[model samples]
Target chain A: MDWNKILLFSILVMVHVPIVSIGQEKLAMQWENVPEEIVQGRLEPQGTASFQRFPQELQKEVREPVWQLSRNSAGLYIDFESDASDIIVEYDVEDQFSFPHMPATGVSGLDLYAMDENSGWQWVRGIYSFKDTISYRYNGIKPAIKGSLRTFRLYLPLYNTVRSLRIGVAENSIFKPIKTKEQNPIVVYGTSIVQGACASRPGLAWTSILGRYIDKPVVNLGFSGNGKLEPEVIDFILRASPSIIVLDCMPNFRDSQKAEESIIKSIERIRAANDTVPILLIEHAGYSDGFVQNERLEIYENLNKATQRAFTYLKSQGINFLHLVKKEDINLGKESFVDGTHPNDHGMVGYAMAISKALTEKEILD
Target chain B: MDWNKILLFSILVMVHVPIVSIGQEKLAMQWENVPEEIVQGRLEPQGTASFQRFPQELQKEVREPVWQLSRNSAGLYIDFESDASDIIVEYDVEDQFSFPHMPATGVSGLDLYAMDENSGWQWVRGIYSFKDTISYRYNGIKPAIKGSLRTFRLYLPLYNTVRSLRIGVAENSIFKPIKTKEQNPIVVYGTSIVQGACASRPGLAWTSILGRYIDKPVVNLGFSGNGKLEPEVIDFILRASPSIIVLDCMPNFRDSQKAEESIIKSIERIRAANDTVPILLIEHAGYSDGFVQNERLEIYENLNKATQRAFTYLKSQGINFLHLVKKEDINLGKESFVDGTHPNDHGMVGYAMAISKALTEKEILD
Candidate 1:
């Protein structure tokens, strides 16, 4: 039995060695010919600081590596200067949710905006198709910003994957990368809503909205329907050591299951591993149609009841730094949902505003 | 020339004869062999009283006849009795927006809901397909309502054409339509937002929410993008003789056009036609994504400025009954739009809640 235990430990170490060796190192990528030097808008690029939450093998094992890779750079927009008349981008993608109502400019694609003189940040171009996994190259014309030097911001797809990406100006034009001062990472973990379901475009997701609102680096840990308080996922989240952690996984739980039990255990594990990091427990935004639909109301009530119980348990544990965000504060009601489950752009805005306020009140953003 | 004008009027009268003859009478349907009785949820049913705003011929001539015909019963719903074990519904539709994100139950078909014994209201079934101009039949099992008798409510599609609809119980079941106590109909005039675009289901629209909240009838005259203060549409709304009129058409105007000019003129026209009707002027919801996108912000600002000017002008004209709804009240920002233009279900709710509060404050619903 001892030999078996040793073998397991050896295997785990072997599995983790490459990941840790890459340790707090910059994300490993095959640098394209363009994008010249620095990866613009990258937040604290793992660089010897041990920031990656998953091993390459684990990233390879996930049903959708895009979800894992996608969240890392969702709100990590870049700024760059180029004297060319136009900009160009190329990216390789694995999966794309081709929702017809939501355009590709918003879904598995890229949207570019440039800072303009009088117009401020204006839309420059968007990679408006995600039907194929090949590189999506887009050409965006310059905005009315003064001078040849310009700052461009690009939004990644909300619910898709980018295997590789490269950006540059038209040939023979000047180019320079820009970066912002690092803010404490705000890591949001939850269900598909947090992963940004149905937002017309990636930038419209609540997590993305909150990122711009607070001007911070945001790591999205939303796992679609898989955010059911799994300890493995929690362990992954702990690696980031985010300044504030948001738990918004109630939507992925069954009513019969005790989210309270999973939540309590998750918090306990998280606190034991790291103390002083503020945690925000978010209750599910009750079904907006629940007002008239009784079964829906019951479902919402049961889910929230479990969440409240979990909060109560957490408070009893002497967690004074913890904060609770009620569904009411999110203000989700009859019309805030898409397909009675996911949030559209409007819903994302409400969620972002509400979370922004709660974080501000907690002084987490301060 | 006089004879020619008389002839034209005669032909127009002939074209409108059948619709005018229907009067404000109950809906005209075959009253077939044993679906048993009244077409379950219809209200006063145009029972020979001339409630319809346009003649059928006139309705057919519009750019999108569906918009006009669809809005007639846009906010209207019915309550009914059924003793059968299950429910069956049939409807004929024109188009279906089979977008993955939008549910067929919400887009081009019917949604049937019943009150359960303890559950209040439960969704029974939805006729979620609309191909061609054929009747679509759908069956839904019964909820746990007390006894064999059941009350059912249904929402019409938000963006499609419903030529006719009917409901039925089992062969030997009972059927009766329940009508509401007459309340002043609240007539709303705006863009597609008022017409219930992107609402998860029709019942979730702000206008629909207000209808349920106030327990009053509502006449929706929203024309998608065509709500740009067209005098012809107002002429039709005036035919309804509503107790209060809400003009939320500012979103439809171009930045170059003055919303105030159109608004003041619309009010003057309405007042001339019906002096005492209270008019509520609502500012635009202000694009939810406007905070980061300056161009969008400018557009919103310009539109609202014109609306404010109109509000001020109306006050100058001694319009005591005119009330203005500020953009702040509607609370729409970047996250509230479906595609940066129309309100999704969530946006509709916020809009409805804000408008409801304002109308209540002004004693409009009272």
Candidate 2:
């Protein structure tokens, strides 16, 4: 309104919300004002549909064969900067489920993380909803870490669609957007686990955890139950020039030969695209309950064997950039699953830790 | 009932439920049929007040000064056995909460485990209620390890009161109670985390995990927000005559000197009663969010210092049976918490692993 009214408003904001620092003027900006380089999830939006994540053609096509792809936001993150002592965010999520077993946080939530000079990237908080009949809004969250200059990263919804998001800081806080560097994004393509099914929050997903652990940006192309090596999806993945590509889609292959055929084809395409970029292949983290269930054990064994055979065949072809991680090394314990299938947070941590350890030991991630 | 009718009913029981091992007469018994030692947690129950966990006096006294204690079922468990292929449980709980942030599973649930010869203790499943105001029924859950005779350990509710319970097994399965040996019952006395707050299920609690890890009977005496080493509670803890006592009560010790005072008194009493029983004193798991919030960091620093001072005093007193575990060794990350205060499953595992490692290193537990 007026200058005096604006001063009164700033005072009111500081007094009412727990998110403001004294003495410094507060600054507010809409999402559109930020530079595009800071946003990382979607392919560059064109024309009037600039805010949409997927390309129009791909979005329309995905709805035909894989409706799950349109809903999954496995590898989307926005990096931002503000010198304010407090940061606030408001976001709306679409298509939230009321599943009795899986909580809303795992279903549709935005995960926040910050990186400092010493610790690299560390998780800060999750903005979630208890119920979402309409769109979900998370408001008045303040996660501004003091003492060090911080680069905050926000992971988008894991299993839901997002309508819009608005982030704010104190009136006088200096702010800027950080675009994802095109140099070498880590690319992880896998089943629902990689897409972050049943993680208590988006940040706890194994892929997200590994990304933070390795201090790099990650592109998640995981489709809930559709990470089977579709040639079309593979074509899309090839567009992202990543330093390393991780494949963990054996669980979705269903049939052993299909798993083998997909694994071979995807590896071949990736090799053709870039002969030197490291490719990491992961076997299925067989159901933990399978230890007691004979039928479940057979399903695990058959799938794992097929992946193993494909790995052996690929190794014989002198593909020096290829690396394989055995499922046993993942060592998911009986306590890891939320349901006997999708992993809980514990399982996600185990999977991330195992993958990180293997990559480090193999000299692929050093 | 007539003899023919009884025979027909037996045949019907065999036909409907998969619990029947066949060829043997079916046997069903109410919880009262089990011996007192086999049904741990509760003291003797007189008259119709059968499902009571603590003695009337303790429950009454707990509510007087420490109301929170009345609601926590931290360390209660039932030790029972049956040869039945499938075991069925029917349990009713009281004071179920509608807090959306925490689920009924963490609030109140029955955690089941079976000890096998090779694997020690393996989790079978948890019986939880998604809604309030009902008794939860777990039916047709078979946990028979093909080669070994299994004895099941059932951890009681974490935050609710159990009104009654029914245990049923296969027609041919022989069931019996295995008492906590007079020589060693792994005893853990701690705060709410040990009291199993926010754990996805009771079995995932650190105390329960350690019990399974060690393959020993355990007595959990965790009191939420009330584990300040009160003399009355200490007296109750001493009754178990355990081989070792683990103290993890830093969270409840909000005041530093008071914490130091309590730890010394408890250790003194335990040493006086049984000089040789090893007592493992644990420092507080400093808040995961403290890495960002200085106010939170100060609370952690103050509490841990108090516990450390108490440990130092105990060691200086020539209490060779005393041992200390630092919270840093626990290594809980930010994602481990559900809220800023309580740990989810991931934090529980880290806590359990750190404590177990310390105990193993000290040779207190082989």
Q: Which candidate is the best by TM-score?
A: 2
Per-residue lDDT of candidate 1, residues B1-366 (tens digit): 353344234222211111111124322222212221222222233421121233444454455653354334344455676654434444555565433334443455454556665645544433233445423232334434545577766666666655455454444456666655455567888887786665656676688677655656776666667778767667767776677889988877876356778988899999889878999999887764454345656887888888888788788888778999998898764445555566665677778889889988988665
lDDT of 2 by residue, B254-349 (tens): 678888888899999988888788899888887755655456678779888888888887888898879888878888887787655777788888
Interface quality of candidate 1 as DockQ: 0.11
Worst 10 residues of 1 chain A by lDDT: A13-22
Model 2 gets an lDDT of: 0.65
TM-score of each model, in listed order: 0.69, 0.81
Lowest-lDDT window of 10 residues in candidate 2 chain B? B42-51
DockQ (C-alpha based) per candidate is 0.11, 0.23
What's the residue-level lDDT of B193 in candidate 2? 81
lDDT (C-alpha, whole model) for all candidates: 0.60, 0.65
Off by over 4 Å in 1: A1-55, A60-153, A162-184, A198-200, A255-261, A288-331, A344-347, A362-366, B1-55, B60-92, B96-152, B163-175, B179-184, B255-265, B283-320, B323-331
